[model samples]
Target: DGVGLMTAADVSAYAHADDGGVEAFVTAGVDVRGWAARPGEGAAGVQDPGTINVVVAVPAALTDAALVNAVATATEAKVQALVEGGYDCSGTPTDAVCVVADAPGPHREAHAFAGPRSLWGARLARAVHRAVLQAVVIADRDGPAVRGQA
Candidate 1:
């Protein structure tokens, strides 16, 4: 249930895009509904506590080669830009972001899912990891009878 809200797949998927549009699309999904976007402007350092949330979606089932290539492509300028632009966090400012993708279907060519670091990327990753685990417990508790429905 909560895992749905903590999906990092998008960041991973777009990180590998050849044209480099992940930040734009991601910012749109993660920002105020009526907000605007500025080139080189990412939500790297900014965070909203409590009710805060991030949404990441990406494609899945990619070949090892493709993923390696995608990582090479995403690592250079994408991660560098944030580092240069003054992203900050307990982790490298770039650690707030993480990408994940899954491939499931009859058949298709392989694709890669890549995620670059976020400003607070590392922190977000850690938090999500823990939150996801708890969500599983919560789901089970509510399932049959663990006495939890909150």
Candidate 2:
């Protein structure tokens, strides 16, 4: 299993945004664990043991519905990453995601909206994508057996 943590500050540095969306900062962390499946088996054929979780800290400007949408966007991005990496998650993966608003900041200004198509949501997706990719790399390096004998 591999775990990756990314803070809003980290994203800010990575995106090189003037504010990194710091005013409405969102932090996303991802844990990705992999399991081996029988050879030649498709996604449904594997008894997958992989799991994914996303935790987020958002600014107060975000709404409850927006929070929920953010979770969905993160989840979709995680699954997309896993699939792109050739993991069969159809049978044996669990994905859990949660989002919480931060205390009122100096701005205290609410966002117009949030969702996968929204700017904030896109940022959240990018953060999650990087984290999950990091975890996968770690898993690959540490455990050759987990992904099937080399």
Candidate 3:
């Protein structure tokens, strides 16, 4: 059977009253159709390449630039988790990453307090990493044939 990994996170940040605080909820998952026994090796008995997808919901106050930064931050964190777990993607990952954010509301004021270096980014990375790690753990416990094969 194919393997799949999933995790999620919810975080919030306080901005000035004028900027209005922001709340971010992120849910991310990594799906591995298949994997090889070793990194950079042929598929052999592994499944197809993996893909990452995320869903983010925030108040309308957030800006487009901030949203973009959030997506990038989340993706980088996902890749970092895979690498730290010993999967060498060689900077070319076949994984498909998707991040969706809700439309802005009128009550909140958009604020780009921090880019990818803010507490918001850190929280997002942690959430994505946690989810990916959970998936990896499941894959490892299942069997040795699929172990460490991303």
- Using TM-score as the measure, the top candidate is 2
In candidate 3, the residue pairs with backbone N, CA or C atoms under 3 Å apart (3 or more residues apart, or in different chains) clash, namely 34-47, 35-47, 60-104, 60-105, 61-110
Shift in Å, residue 92, candidate 1: 1.1
Say which prediction, candidate 1 or candidate 3, comes out ahead on TM-score.
Answer: 3
- Which lDDT tens digits does candidate 2 get at residues 10-80? 34322111123422222222233333343664546543344444555554467666767777776776666
Ranking by lDDT: 2, 3, 1
Give, for candidate 3, the lowest lDDT window spanning 10 residues. Answer: 10-19
RMSD of each: 16.6, 9.1, 9.7
Ranking, TM-score, top scorer first: 2, 3, 1
Candidate number of the best lDDT: 2
List candidate 1 stretches off by more than 4 Å: 1-56, 68-74, 83-97, 112-150
* Clash number for candidate 1: 18
**Can you write out model 1's per-residue Cα lDDT over 49-88, one digit (the tens) per residue?**
2111223333444456544544343333333332232222
